[model samples]
Target chain A: MMIKRLTNKLLMGIIIFHILALSLLPPFTFTEVKAAADSPGFIIQADWVVGKNMTPSIVFTETSGSDKTPMLRVHYEEAVIYGMKLTKQFSTPSGPVSLTLKADGPVRMSGMTVDTSSLSFKGACLRATENIPDAGLEDVTMVVHYMNAGGSNIEQLSLQTVDGNQGPAKPKKTQILVDLALLPYTQALKEVEKISSGKKPLVCDEPVADEGDVKPGEPKASIPDELSREDLVPGEEVIEDRVGKVTDPVTKVIDPATGVIEPVTGITDPITDPVKDIVKPVEKVIKPVTKPVKKVLKPVTKPVKKIVKPVTKPVKEVVKPVEEKLKPVTAPVKHALSESCKRVKDTKGKITKDLGLDLIDQALKEGKTLPELCKGDASLTRALEDFEDGLTDILGLDFIFKALGQDEEAKLKRMKETLKNQKDNFIISL
Target chain B: MEEREQEVQVRSGFSKKAFWTSLASGFLLLGLLLVSFGISGVACAVPIAGVGDFYVKFDQLEGTGYTFYPKLGETSSSDSSPQGTNLIKDVTIKNLQLYKDFKVGGDTIRVLITASKPVRITGLHHDAGLIQANAKFQNLTLKENNSSNWQKQFEQTSSKITLENAKLKTHYLFQETINMAGMKLTVEKIK
Candidate 1:
């Protein structure tokens, strides 16, 4: 059949020339992983450290105990440190030395790794206060001064809560975390899980009472004011025991059958050392030893028993003074918030549920006013004239023209009554 | 035979008119042999009388540079001439014609005359100063009292005459004359 129709037109032109050579290739791929951070791993390049408080120093990479805790965040409204001075006078162990550290205000370093394991520090600049109010921001310090090489000691760190959105609907960046081994701090507070798990050392959760109970290493007995007939030291004395290693907590006693520690000397019956393996037993069991109680005499003023025995200190005096009675300042709430103005939109609950009242609409419509629609935010023009007078007392020009015309008023009222009847039949035929 | 066939039929009628008259006499003898060579090329172009006559004959003769200047410019030497040595042998002059004269004081002026070399005069006579000759050769025959005593001694010849095979006949005049008898000059005045 003509060679099978020339092999089916050469297999349909080799399957359309391999689909036009795979549709001219190129699908997706990428590279440039890092480098090009728009340049600047360290560059003060030029600086005078303004009004001179110029403290220049450099050195960081010494961490210990949990690799010396310090995740990144160095926020800066200030910073400044430039240096050079070593023209061959290099002495160290706390003496003369200077070579690099160059910093300038808006510093960086957050969670490190813009290469060379990041957090690199070096002095001055800091600044950032301006519109304050995040509940009046309590702490923001920065200081970092170690001045002459080994003259190490001025690290004031602590300004870290700036993660991501610092608000008015978010976009101004900040991140701040510092700790570089706490060198010169000026305010500090950590425990956001120990500086976000840079690892362990924030401890203190409360555990106090072991000093007076004394059961850790035992030793006590010295009550001999001339033993009365009742001191009973007759031949009826019976004492058989053997245990050791009690370095005096008023004369030892901890022998759970030969696990040894028993120094009992003329005891009055107050022995406790069930082994806590010595070592200053709670500062030697709060010292003051010399005990002797055993009298059964009646009280000098007791007519009868006036017992108040349910005293668990009256339930720890009513649950420990309600835990130091504090927490009460109030008034900073502000929450109804279902969506702040990011770019904008509120419409005050669809104009106060169609005119019942109490509103605040303004998501910028074009009828102007409100200082002509905040013409460049002179601080949002008094919240846009109190949201345009709360949306004109909540929609009343007939519910703002029926919520601005329920679907365009019946085809614009039949095209305005057919152009008003053709202008009244052309003014009654003119 | 009937009189020998009438003499063979009158000699075959004279041999058939003599074979048609010998073929018209062989085309009239080949047209008279082409008119006898075109009459011998017109008789070889005439002239056979003396055929460019060339001759040398001598008789008593004498010659010298002859000059005779008489009038008043008088100094004369008679003979040293050899030009044409006075040639007269059969007197042949093929051409020449000349006439000149100048005798200032006694008035006889007619100067300038010229022609020479192609000539045939035979006889001539001129007066009023020269050239009167008769029976002159170049072919001649003259008489009449020998041309009247050679025209009266050519008017008492007083000097220039050079006529050869001459011709100048103002009616053989006796006055008013200017003649060049084939370059034999003559000029005359008779008042």
Candidate 2:
């Protein structure tokens, strides 16, 4: 009787636990990937089968599945998607799926990270090639071996919801792949414009059911609810902030020189003027020190120049003619300065490259947001363009310095000053 | 004595029955609750695609291309260093889309929204002077079948890197371009 009573108590605890677990489990969410042009937003390929060509177009796939995987594991999710397609199994929104493909042709697969410039791959064979041949067969499946291949942050993806019932675009010899898109190009673009700000495309198999529990009006798929009490529907403002990306006003800084806002400074200030903000304070500190120092130097230098000039004048005239006999300089620096303004080479190795394009491409392929990619593009266009405009001025100064027979060190100093001056007073005529 | 013992036995039996009946009812209650929770859990599973479909498209290249660096720091890596190779290509650029914001080392350079097929990017790197990238092209067939619509590709490295804007003739390219569009780039600080 005691044993029976104990058993009854144990059963009661188990029953209570089961009910509580069921209530707390979160809802099952399916993240859909759809290309607006070729495919509508997210889609489901229910009951997909291997095509008649004996090759599969889309292997096994899940609508809402894991896009994250450990580095050592085959992007297990991508692996399953491709593996299932390779094995020819139908995948569901929440069903377990896997796929494996061997290179029958020159195929490339790469793992993408949130940092576009990052070369790390979280799963599978990390491979990529710039070149790929035209399709020899119609139904050969091209696998997406990337976790973020759908470009979650960029809101870009090509998802097809094809199942067994849906057949291939009728195979043709000269079939152009242009019309295979789900929506017409222009029409799809209109759709993207309308939704670009408000909606976020659930990444490739990335479930975004911020709404944890499935309410009556919510999606009705048989997903195990892993309900957590704290999970709340994300506010629309957050989504809009990420998607709409309203350009916050460009911050402006006043230029001390002109008492007006200068094109933003220090982004790539050649002069490295991120300290422009502290320039006033620094000037204040230096003014006191420099004022007395300059006063002393000025009196000393004047006496020294007066004494040296008379003595040097007689010798300089003798040296002047000798220097004049030197080789003729090509396109006197003045002519070169003006002529080369339209065409000139900056110092052989002074220009700075933004690396923006390369990093952006990598970022897009890796699927990072614009702001993230922006970090890679450190450009000071206003500064650079102004510097370019000041090229003539710098070159003219170079010639003057050379004509004065200044030493190389003095020439370099003047060049630096010229650049600073350019930044202060550059006005592009053209 | 026998009559008293008979009364005690009848009371004990009644007490045991009451205990068993209450226990059975408790178990029955738990079982019903378990079923109800399980059913509700199943009902809450939401199909993601059922959230409704949006078939919108982007007509413009909506972003700043990249941050332009006019000057590198005294010890910038891009200065006086031979970056990656610059393999030039002579292919007409059609339907190019710039990003909303471009950066020095990261940003989208080549986005073929509705342009020719198989556009190849050879190398795109930043230098101390300005931003430069190289693209390659093969036998490009224009959509309008006008093969001779455009001239040779844009190719120039070093000082000859063209600063002025130029145009490329297109065959069946549709829509106007917006490089400086709605997107504005924000540069808070630079290294």
Candidate 3:
């Protein structure tokens, strides 16, 4: 009896709890679909099947009890009919006149096409028209035809309402105009076919050739105006070029008159000329002192010395200029100029042969070339000066400094100012 | 004399038993009356009542897109935190009080609107009873002295309170957003 009473109480509590819960639960409802075009006019819509070449007919309807009369007017700019025929007869309930229509080849209808398989109906009449008061169609089906391959067709889409309700031509025709846009697509496809036949068509299945193998004999996609000799002897020149790049070759001379020191910079390339604007004054002063001393002193006594010097050492391996030295000196200063053109000769030895102008300078300064001290030292000075001039002229200090990770002084000042402004902004925020 | 004594003892026994039984029955009857009184008080006292979908929204009145349904039954009472005494009855909240665990800058914010009052929120180490008017995290306290008994009705059965124009208070582990739609809140005895 006690257990029964307890069970009844528990059941009552559960029932009360469930009843409260059921009353408290909320319900939900969803709204229905309604879409309207932003523009006002006749709307032509169709459902098209993908991968299948078929068109659905357009149907127009006038809503009931609407104040305005609905009509469809077709203004055809052009029309083409193919592979079909048309039949027409004027029929009157009071009296009838018989009209005969003939069969044609493939019917092609332009401006619009009404495929009997695709079209539901094609004609135009307002709801006000008593003949077909309920008929919603707006355009007439005048003629039909079909076309063979490579057929000519062109047309424009327009409308003429019986009500003269025309103003600016409405552009809501975009829905129907899309199917007619095939005119441009057909033209473009023809152009693509022509292009493919004339040029190498892109092949999807062919494996891509390695860029390295396809490189040779392939016309260079980009040809520089100048070809680098470094390309010919890349291995031989790599080291000397690397050393020349690192070592400071130019000795900058400050003209006391200008109060500006022209810092000697190294030439990026041994062949490129030095910057001219910065080194012009220094070059003008140094050239007169160096060139004449080389020419006059070299010829007055060394013609005989140059002739005998190569012979003194039999193992010295005289190449071509052994015996012809005096004749060349006598030939003119031009011959001596070419003979002493060690810069050019060294370049010819290998693309990278270092002329070692620095070593030559050390040899002259150490008095190691005591026998030909004048010639060796003079050649060294000329080579060193030329290198200095080349560096000064080719590599602008301002430009190089920027490239080597240094900021412009003005930019640094601006950055400082910006930092100060940010500090002030932070204080204002606080 | 023995027989006379026996009769007196028997009369005394009967009287004693009768008195004891009467007293016991009387006490039981009093207890039943008290229990009935309590049950009727609970049945007729009326659970806190207010708007069915009562909510105080902060900032934008309508656009916060937050709805708080108070589940007063699920309240966990704690004496430590200021907003520990919550009167909310039965409901779960999304966005209005509880938020997804997320990090903003270098701080982690986790907030939930339990049935606990903002002033009695336990585990929160906030000095002020009320945090910011629109505290984004944790249970926040409404101001005292309010005419509308939303807090009262909420404590009894549950109702969805849409709170707007609230501020947030920073607590030890989290911050609490308080509904300050009005200036005052009052305490009421809920069913």
Candidate 4:
């Protein structure tokens, strides 16, 4: 009975210990419990696994590291892989040419086995290695390391097997139908095709028939030796007569040089002659009345003049010295003010030159009116306005015009003239 | 006779108490074992680490509505064609195999892949990469620019592009929109 009790305690202790040990052991030891299917699959071990639009059915192999959960299956449906590189050395006529192909596109795969210590989805590390449901990721970029040797055109490429053997004895025939627009270098290809097919040259040397030339056996209508206004229209002669009569007087009145209208040379003579005859009778009647009034005013003016002359002379004498005394003080002040204004102008000139504002000013000086320079250029107009405002703040409205060696009123007048000319041209041109 | 009966009763009572204790302990052990199995099952669900170098191969590959940009720039003198965005309507590959090689001690460990069916992808956009392939075109057209300032001398287009017994290699292959049929994998070691 003592031995049975001892054995029971010992067995319990052993069972507890075994359970603890089994629990402590890594879970990978039990992977045999869930056997993977025997089917066609792929295994890829990349230093870095980065992709997107991945709906992959992936299985993870056991690995050692802090990351306990490794991605087992990913159903990367439409995944974009970035920076995938492959290189091969080929024997060419020149020498050995190393060719490297880099690709980035949507990849489709089936039965793929991915092995990586680090696997991330959308840049975040997967915490667990389980069947990742549809991981529809977009824009997964990766970095690949490789070397580039030199240039090898795709046209120069030749078939080679995995064992690096040359072209096959009997090449398989394949046909690809492609749209012309989808292909690159379309125009170049068309030209080559044209040349190879011996098509007609784009530029032909054949002489073209003139539209005015009359062909053999074709009837030609006779043309009149001269064109007549009366033949073209029945009332054209009368219209010409009326038009000439109206234009003759207008031409005589308008001065060509000034583009201004002047009265016809003899137009005012008849009116002036009639006015002179009427004025002669009226003048005779008014003469006697005017003579009496003038005699009455002459006596009153003499006395007043004598009294005012003495007072004005004394006032003028007193003001002369005061004016002379103030000249010395005011002259230097005016000179200093002018000098400061000139200095400000000079500083502004420098700033304008640095800012390229001087180019506009130069163009203005070159006879480009403000309107002409600012036409079709809103930014230039705004810049000029801003510059004008800056000058107005520092000096005054007329300062910029003065600095340009022109009067503000003259500049405005010129601008108006330019605008008027432009408007007139716009109307006439249409 | 009375003393012997009392001793027998005490011994029976002790045995019954010991039996109950043993039975309780056995139940506790079973519960602990179940809890441990549950924990391990959860752990196993986590991703296993991967081993090896990157390698992939396909028996046949086909793509539709393909477009590629050479990005040769605007000048005629520039010969360097950089990678740009490329597009395809859909793509399919048959008998696909991929392998990742690893060095364990002196031997190389890799995943061996058998034959597989077709993998399909739709609406693929390729951003950048270089590709080398043997190709031939039918009804090809070539246009030339003779301008002194032009960097590229000629441009080409074709009604059809046929690649037979052609080997295509790529560097930096990044893509999108993929689907694969069956998958089978096995690991192998080589010295």
Candidate 3 structure lDDT: 0.27
Q: How well does candidate 1 score on lDDT at residue A311?
A: 45
Give the Cα-based TM-score of candidate 3 against the true structure.
0.10
Model 1: per-residue Cα lDDT at residue A289: 55
Candidate 1 ranges with C-alpha deviation above 4 Å: A1-27, A30-73, A81-195, A199-382, A385-430, B1-191
The reply for model 4, stretches above 4 Å from the true place, is A1-430, B1-55, B70-86, B103-105, B112-115, B125-175
Q: What is the TM-score of chain B alone in each candidate?
A: 0.18, 0.19, 0.20, 0.42
DockQ of each: 0.00, 0.01, 0.01, 0.04
Per DockQ, the best of the predicted structures is: 4
- Between prediction 1 and prediction 2, which has the larger DockQ? 2
Quick one: how many clashes does candidate 2 have? 65
Alpha carbon lDDT at A44, candidate 2: 12
Question: What's the distance in Å from true for residue A56, model 2?
Answer: 28
lDDT digits (tens) for residues B46-148 of candidate 4: 1111221134456555554333322321112222323233344455656756555656457787755433656565554432332233343322222222222
Q: Give the per-residue lDDT of model 1 (tens digit) for A1-430.
A: 9999999999999999999988866542121211121111121122222111211112232121121223332221222222211001111223322122212222221111111112222221222111111111111222111111101111111111111212111111122333433543323233333333442211111111212222111221121224323456677442324354587667576666856687878948676867675565354456685787778787789566886667454333433445577779898845333233312234432222211111122322333333344454444445545544443322112222232365433323322222221212221100
lDDT (tens digit, per residue) of candidate 2 on B50-86: 1111111222221111111111111122222211112
Best by lDDT: 4
Best by TM-score: 4
Q: Can you write out model 1's per-residue Cα lDDT over B1-191, one digit (the tens) per residue? A: 99998888876564656765885676467445434533342212111111111111112111111111101000112111101112111122333333333454566644222334332221121111112221111101000111112111100110112222323211111111122232322235433
